[model samples]
Target: MRYDVNLSILFTELPMLERPAAAARAGFDAVEMWWPFDGPTPADAELDRLAGAVTEAGVQLVGLNFDGGHMPSGDRGLLSSPATSRRFRDNIDVAVGFAERLGCRTLNALYGNRTDDTDPELALENLALAAKAAGGVGATVVVEALNSFENTRYPITSSAQAFQLLDQVPGTAFLADFYHLGRMGEDLSALIANHADRFGHVQIADVPGRGQPGTGELDYAAILRQLADSPYDGHVGLEYKPVGPSEESFSWLEAMP
Candidate 1:
């Protein structure tokens, strides 16, 4: 069971450009992230700099999310919104190109918050479109399920819901985030046992407060052991918020069995 630190959440005290090296120095050899720019389209110079940072750090860029609206302001995603479909389409090439440059194979497509004005069919159509574009570059699209408590407007709140959308997009797979499912009171063990083959990637954070593994009630060692025994071979992304300094928060890594 290998692990990758999510730079978007951990080591966030540093500038975005410096986080990859910071994570590498902290003994992480791989990293993942949400859209690193303020918008779907960023200047080529900015893109090159970020790609250079990851390369200079010598870490594998594993997973990345397509533009998920304003993450800091809690916009879950843009794909599900009719208004943002154009932006989502525009971002496909940019996101795929960046991933290809970094040798990243898994691209997460967050299902945006549901709106009365947005037709579900349109959202599905856009997701399939994104999948087709990413597939052309030999990358897989991943659909994630968010917790209802924090993401009330985001409709895909369960493994069942995520799979439904995944079915619509042929090459897409489900991103099983234990933290979100556990926070929603879903059976993590059962989910892993039943759908491990369908998971393209996995992310972890402890429940209750979304902190490091030990800071909450999740039995990660047991969960990881299950993953190891199962068919899921993807890296487990450490997506938790540190309770203290990010470096100090890594004691749980050494403690993982």
Candidate 2:
């Protein structure tokens, strides 16, 4: 099981432009990120600089998110929002282009919060459109489940909800984040056994506090062993919050198989 740092969370002490090198210095060869800018599209020069940073650091960018509107703040995603559908549509090409240039193949499309006026049909349609666009670039779209506690407005807060959306989008797959699922009290072991083949990528953080693996109760060794035996052949993204300095949080990496 290869491990990749999620630069969006780790090495956040540095400027976004300096993080890839910082991650490389910390001994990571691959990284993943959320959409790093506030808007759906950033200037071409900014994209070029970010791409250059990763390239210069000699790290592979394995995954990225589509503009999931102001993450950790308010909206979880724009794709499903009737008001922001146009922004979501406009972002697809630019996001796909960045992934292509960075050699990142997995793109996580977050399902937005469900409003009183939100139409489920429209959300499905938008997701399908996003998946089709990503497929054209030889990439796979991934839908992830966030915990309802933190993402109360986000509709797809469980694996079941995520699967339902994936059914509507033909070529997309699931991103099984253990921390979120575990927080929702899903049986992690059984989920892996039943849906391993459906997973495009996997992310991990210990539950309770969303800290690094050992800081909480998750049995990562057992989970990793299960993953190794399962059909999923992908990197496990370290998408946890650092308890101390980000560099010190990596002690758990030595324990991983």
Candidate 3:
């Protein structure tokens, strides 16, 4: 099982490329990001620079969040916003270019929930269109469902609902976060096994606090064993906030199968 570090938490203390190197130094094989495409609009040259960092650090940019909704002050990212529809498409085109440069093949398109009168069908249509746009660059798009308790605006919650959305879209898939799935009242192992076919990327965090593994109530070892037994082959993105120092929180990496 390869591990990835999301640079959202530690980018300030280390260089972008050094984030992966830090994880590698701690015995991880890969790294990821929430959204590394946020700089003066989006461009391939910038992404190529990021790719260069990853190559220089000898770590893979396994996954990235193409949507930019998590910014403060509650602005929904693309795939769900009408005002930024064209802008979002343009951003995704730029992201694809960056993905190619980094050799990253999987992208998490977290569509922010709309609180307006926009019909659900319209949202699905926009999401499908965005997925098609991502597929054009040979990158598989995985629509992730965030827990409403933590992110009250995130729309898709249940695994079944995420799968249903994927069913609606032709070339899209579902990303299952154990922390979110458990928060939304789904059995982790059962959900993982049942949707094994549709699972693209998996993230883990302990319950109640979203901390590192072994700090909370998540049975990560069991989950990893089950994933190892399944046909699913993907990298597990670390999307939790570190309770203390970043490296200290990940000592449990030695415990994952």
Each model's Cα RMSD? 0.8, 0.9, 2.1
Candidate 1 to truth, TM: 0.98
Extract clashing residue pairs from model 3: none
| Tens digits of lDDT, candidate 2, 1-257 | 88899999998899998999988998889999999977888999889999999999999999999998877678888877689888888899999999999889999988788887687787788888888888988899999999989988888878998898888779999999999999999999999999999999999999889999988889998999999899999999999999999988988877778
Per-residue lDDT for 18 in model 1?
A: 94
Q: Report residue 15 deviation for candidate 3 (angstroms).
A: 4.5
TM-score of each: 0.98, 0.98, 0.90
Number of the predicted model whose lDDT against the real structure is largest: 1
Provide the clash count, candidate 3. 0
Q: What tens-digit string does per-residue lDDT give for candidate 3 at 1-257? A: 76677777643377665676677776666788877655415565666677777787788887877756547556545676666566666666666667777778887776766667445665677677667777787878887777778678667788877887888888888888888887777888887677777878888888878888877787899988998787778888888878887877877877888
Worst 10 residues of 1 by lDDT: 248-257
